[model samples]
Target: MRCEEGPLSEVYDRLRAEIVDGTLAPGAALVETTLAERYGTSRTPVREALRRLQQDGLVERADRGMRVRTRSPEEILEIYEARIALEATAAAGAAQRRSDFDLVRISRAQKTMTATPASDPAAMAESNRAVHEAIWAASHNGTIVDLLTRLNNHLTRYPWTTLSMPGRWEEAIVEHAEIIDAIEKRDSDRAYELAREHMTKARELRLRIYGDDATA
Candidate 1:
């Protein structure tokens, strides 16, 4: 069946992208009328988008109405911990079961991402997500992939502009290369450890950005 991208879905996707990329800062209000006007749609679609955002944990209902959700340092750490568990397991499974076609696809995606200029944060984020999803799919575990997909949506809610910083993008490319190598070697343990370590570094970067400040 061909999935429909209705007005509501369009608004949802746009708002979600903005939220993920930090265009919509944490704690910023999402006024339905303003969004409706901006998107050239009715308030109905905007409301629907807000509802979907809430479901995705990107936005929350506040006393003044809808506001972008903010991640506390503790919460960010917890989320990364959860990611390590889920993604490490998935990477291990992928190492065990990945097909040659899967490896090729993953290699291509990573190459495209690494080739992209570091100055393009938007493109980098898109390609980074693509490579990760490809690896997740290689595992051939539907349930695990679905869970990671949902978690990733929540994870993106936090501003991760660190990837745009000097050297970090290169670091990420190298880390991805290591992950691909481990999977290609069919070393499940190594793949799992690399995945966990990669996320741990990501968590550290986020902590540096958000800091221990509770108000941040």
Candidate 2:
């Protein structure tokens, strides 16, 4: 994929990254004038960036103004349902089609994830993206990969990782290994089953962690 470019693009990319990484948070007021000043630019680019973000589902119209989108538990769960469907199918395809090159990339990402402690949500989230993206790439389906990329970006806007829950890191490590093993052995059914189960577990853990925030 072509990486985004230029100053305006940089501003947009950084803002979007901060939103996902929680520097800019849900319901946080985003003033184009203020952001333009902060980024040493005019409000025009900031305005455009916010428009782009809104289109991408990271920003939303609010009574106060445009703000980072806050999602309900139901909405979040629905997003995960879509993700599970896409990724499970991708994983199944990956199992049947992954090349040695794909395995190498997947292994590296899996190792990085395992090496990170569960207490470190940031590191785990990054590695988690890598592992999942590798599987998506392995599937060799451009449309599904593009859709999943957009979905995952929106998913990361939530502030915490399911891995930070007690014992969740260990569980993820085991689960990821099983999925990778299934692909290695060309077991598409097992890969699909494992991937679907993985997403279901993630959605449950996230809802548990969100607690009152989920409902509110």
Candidate 3:
């Protein structure tokens, strides 16, 4: 059966994208009237969008209306730790269970991420997310996909992307390629090792961005 979506879904998608790309930053006010005016729609869709955002952990109710959810530095670090553990497991599963279609989709996502034209930071961030999600889907495990998606949505609360750091994007391209190769070869043990190493190095890079305060 075909799914039917209305204005509410469109509004939700736009708002969610903005939130993920840091356009609607953490703690930014989300008044229905203002959003409706901006989107040139009515309050109904705005309200609906806010509701979905709350469900997605991107926003929270406030006394005035709602606002983008914010996380403390410590909370963000803890969340990354969770992501590292979960994603490594997912990668191992993908190596074991991935189909031909899954491999093709992941390769396409990798190309999108490493586009020769060099996309802007926001586009690059979304591309990075796409690759990770492709791997998650390739695992053929619904539970891990759901867990990783939620963690990633929370991750977007950070204003800066680890991929934007100098040399980081190039480094990630090589790392991702290795991960994909391991999965393609159906080397589950190697995939698990590469996944942990990838995330651990990424965490270290991100911590460097946060500097002394986060590393502590």
Candidate 4:
């Protein structure tokens, strides 16, 4: 959770936030000198930040310079597929290993998500991410948490949230409830199945939305 402290960290944090929030849209150019001037620092920090972002898969080398990555639908689907596998494993681990404190945190996160207004898709999406983060933490596997965090960053780059789709908010809440129930009961197998099913539904909805958007 602790990032390096310094000018480079500042630049990286600012840029990453902008990209995730869609201020720096996909395919947008990332010019080093321009960012350096904007951040009121020399190009050194900007250059290093850009390099780190590239390694994080948030930026890519463009014909002229680096730019925010623009993922194709297929690429997005692949990321979701990876998430499905990892999330299921994390859920199983949580069921077997979660402490009372961990369960409380997970329940709180889910409650926050449920309380968020469906009309506010962005807030709902953020709360939804929080729920998963708690679940991942309950798993007590740093490696899985790290990988899922990276994949989530990539997914959040998209401006839209699947939670915005009609009925999806309710559906996701129900699905999350089932997963929570399994975890609370210490049923690892059931937790794994529920988590896999949840992510699979999300992937399906995402694909359907992409197809609809393409046609639209």
| Candidate with the greatest lDDT versus the true structure | 4
Worst 10 residues of 4 by lDDT: 1-10
Tell how far residue 204 is off in model 1, in angstroms. Answer: 0.5
Error of model 4, residue 10, in angstroms? 2.8
How are the candidates ranked when ordered by lDDT, highest leading?
Answer: 4, 2, 1, 3
Clashing pairs in 4: none
lDDT of 3 by residue, 1-216 (tens): 212233888889989989877788778999987888777788887888898789778899878879998767676678879989888999999999999999999999999888934448878778888888999999999999999888877776666678877888898899999999999999999888898888988777766776753456
> lDDT tens digits, residues 4-31, model 1?
3337778898889888777898899999
For model 2, residues 1-216, the per-residue Cα lDDT tens digits are: 222232678789989988887788688999977887777777777888999998788999988779989867887788888999998999999998999999999999999988887767789888888899999999999999999988876776777788878788898889999999999999999999999999999989878877856557
Q: C-alpha displacement of 130 in model 3, angstroms?
A: 3.1
Per-candidate TM-scores read: 0.83, 0.88, 0.79, 0.91
Every candidate's lDDT: 0.85, 0.87, 0.84, 0.89
lDDT, model 1: 0.85
Off by over 4 Å in 2: 1-6, 21-23, 63-65, 212-216
lDDT of 4 by residue, 67-159 (tens): 999967897788998999999999999999999999999999999999999989779989999999999999999999999998886776666
At residue 186, candidate 3 shows an lDDT of 95
